[model samples]
Target chain A: MDYDYIDRLLERYWKCETSLKEESELRTFFSKSDMPKRFLPYKDLFVYQQIQKTVGLGSDFDVRVLSKIEPPVVKAKRLTMFVRIKPFLRAAAAVALIVLCGNITERSYFADDKLDYNYKDYKDTFHDPEVAYKKVSSALMMLSEEIKKSKSQHFPDSLYQNDLDSVCTK
Target chain B: MHEFSFQDDILPLKDKLFRLALRITMDRAEAEDVVEEAMVRVWEKRESYSNYDSVEAFCLVVTKNLALDMSQKKDAQNLSLDESMAESEMDESDPYHQLANNEKLKLIHRLINELPERQRLVMQLRDIEGESYKKIALVMNITEAQVKIDIFRARQKVKQRFLEIDGYGL
Candidate 1:
């Protein structure tokens, strides 16, 4: 029997020129028991690869891996419009409660007191314009005096200038 | 687009992923762990599966990365392929042929395992798994040229080593 085809294929295989199909053919040819004596040396290489193909994990491997892995995510239930908006609705309700409480507290603490005060009876203590003018002039004079006293206690400009001049000179 | 189901689409790829992980980690238990983690990761990103060109390629890439990480972390030792397992797979009736075939198989395994990591992985993906060069490139994050080069180098090395042993009766 002529092995010229297999020899040619094997040469191409070692050269990395064989197509996947041709390589499979070589594997098949080498797998048989009736190969010529000269081809026996190369037989083991192909046979070993064939055997390695069968080297795989046992059936239990699937169970082991599946147990470790999470199952495929179940398709999510279609949410109703209300269900989708529930979180936003809760937030809006919280905000509305806060605002309502704020309004109530403000009315309790401020509105009644403001309304009870009599704005209509708010008349000026000084009915005469001349007397009111004199009281205003006196208050202004006291304020002027206090301003003069504070000005007198201001940091001395001459002392500040001296410190500055000394530092510059140094 | 066909719907991607974890049970139908992804889980069936566990054996392929396991073989890839096993090739890298060189330890069955570690490879199993890597494959499990990879599956879980792919499941976690299931929503984005459609974004990828191929979910199978994506799973392979994930498994490769996890296996690399595990192997690196442990400084993967050169664990021999289980001989008993291979023996059980043999259906030979003659004891003489079985013994000789087993020795040859062992030699082939050692030759492959002795290859550099990238070459070993490329050969495994190309020869055993029958992956396309494009897919191997995607999984390994290398150019198709580089994948072919690695496969070529790996096959040549195995051939050279096997010839050296067989010729000298080592």
Candidate 2:
């Protein structure tokens, strides 16, 4: 298939005379699987021509050189969910914390220890002052005992909730 | 201004720049330095890079200039001939490993390097980089015909060398 022409092209190619298209044709001609023995000698050259397509500096070259360039600029995405919702998440957490602390503090506020219980004041406040005080004191003593027991025994927090419910039911 | 990714417009050219540097300086370390300097020059002066054709070719031209300057300076140092030749061999790494098992192409690649510097440059720019004739002519600052002649001569050399090694298939 135009072997003479290819041979001539090969001759031109060696002397730096052939055009790129001609050289490529020569390569393609030799690239076929059925390249004749007469053409086999030229086969590798064509194959190598194609292979030169892969040649260049090695792979790590970019890594080596670009190491000195500025570190990549990270542009913040205006629409990313995490970024858009970040403020809300923080605010929610802060509100939750404040609410939790306030709830705890409100419970502690009612537990103030400085009660000036004058006998007359106690009498005025109760239908049966002695009986009512005795009942209230006994209930408080029971609650205090349960709290101490739970603290020492490491009871589930549900026990505290239950205690609050039962005692506050009165 | 050239509008493109660092990868698209710049990073991808590393191997080509490396090859150009390696060809001129023939030492990996020195070629690497040249490529870095070239990249810096490109990046720093990129504002002047009008969004015209062939940004890659522009970078390559800059790299070639840098490598050529370095090589010329070293040549001026008047090193011993033996030392200069040895340095040239240092960075001339094999471009064949990238090829498939085609001996013809390997032979041609070697022959292409054996070509005169002008011819080799022509082939590298036109064939290896797939640059357009106009763009390559611009890069080399040569007229289109000179580029064509040089490339033609380079291909002819490769073909001749391949045939000679093949012994005309015995």
Candidate 3:
């Protein structure tokens, strides 16, 4: 191609007059092994473009990314299955705790259990160990309820964290 | 599908994206980061590939967007200079000519960086990407005519610099 024609196209190129096809044609024309001196300024751009087109991610990168995902959590994010449902599970657990703890002051279930432990006279006459066993169980239940309510009502806010912490702290 | 293999699709685009990112960022690491980010993004969004006009155009848009975003996020991230890529490229001219092209490319990158954001985008998409006007418009969220005008201004500014550097007095 004539330098003047190419130079004209390039002039149009920088001015946005060349169409995409025209622009590529200009690049292809200038990308030749030889070019007029006036056109030499543009050779790097096209040659660099041709080089760029052949570059690829090295296999090591693929290996690195695959290994990163092998720990299950990455897979969990990719699958979106567990992530999508995780919030609902946490919300359910939080609401359950709220309901259980919020009503702690009433001691509704403990009141009935406490009523049954008043059989101390019968226990003394019959010398039954079963009545003593029932009393111990009721007292343990009352203590656990108070502990749960205090923890839930205070700092253990996130339901998921609370569940994990409870299991871990033991 | 084999059509989207990293070697075929991504490697082929590396040199182009490297230069594109280099031109926009004027830094090799930033360019590399943009290219890698683009690759990972393409990998992640591969399932949605069928929806785009062409994967090449889609990838270019992604690359350009990431380069733009990275430039905006950190001034330091984009300040480094690019090394001479002249060793890998073919040139029939004297080594000085190659040197000139490299310098011009660096200068072009700087000039393009200072363009209005839209002009910079349109210039990169239309010129560097060799994208069709319609695709450039789509990527830029503008009309084809708007893409054309912005591209025109961008091209003109670069040509102005090119002419000045080459002493083309016109």
lDDT of 2 by residue, A1-170 (tens): 87789778877666556665776687678768885567776566556545556546665867766666668889976688898899999999999999999989988998777678676665355687789889999999999999998786686779868988999998
Q: Candidate 2 at B16: error in angstroms?
A: 2.2
For model 2, state the Cα shift of residue B98 in Å. 8.9
Error of 3 at A156 (Å): 63
Residue by residue across A1-170, what tens digits does model 3's lDDT show?
56678878877776667766877887788678887776666675555444333433455554543443234553323647788899999999999999988678568656666545556655354467899799889999999999998877786459768788899989
Better of 2 and 3 by TM-score: 2
TM-scores of all models? Answer: 0.63, 0.56, 0.49
User: How many pairs in model 3 have backbone atoms within 3 A of each other, for residues 3 or more apart or on separate chains, i.e. clashes?
Assistant: 9
Off by over 4 Å in 2: A1-29, A57-59, A71-170, B80-110, B165-170
Leading candidate by lDDT: 1
TM-score-based ranking, best first?
1, 2, 3
List where candidate 3 sits over 4 angstroms from the true fold: A1-15, A28-170, B1-12, B75-105, B168-170
Better of 2 and 3 by DockQ: 2
Candidate 2: DockQ? Answer: 0.26
Model number with the top DockQ: 1
Kindly give the number of clashing pairs for every candidate. 0, 22, 9
As a whole number from 0 to 100, the lDDT of residue A18 in candidate 2 is 61
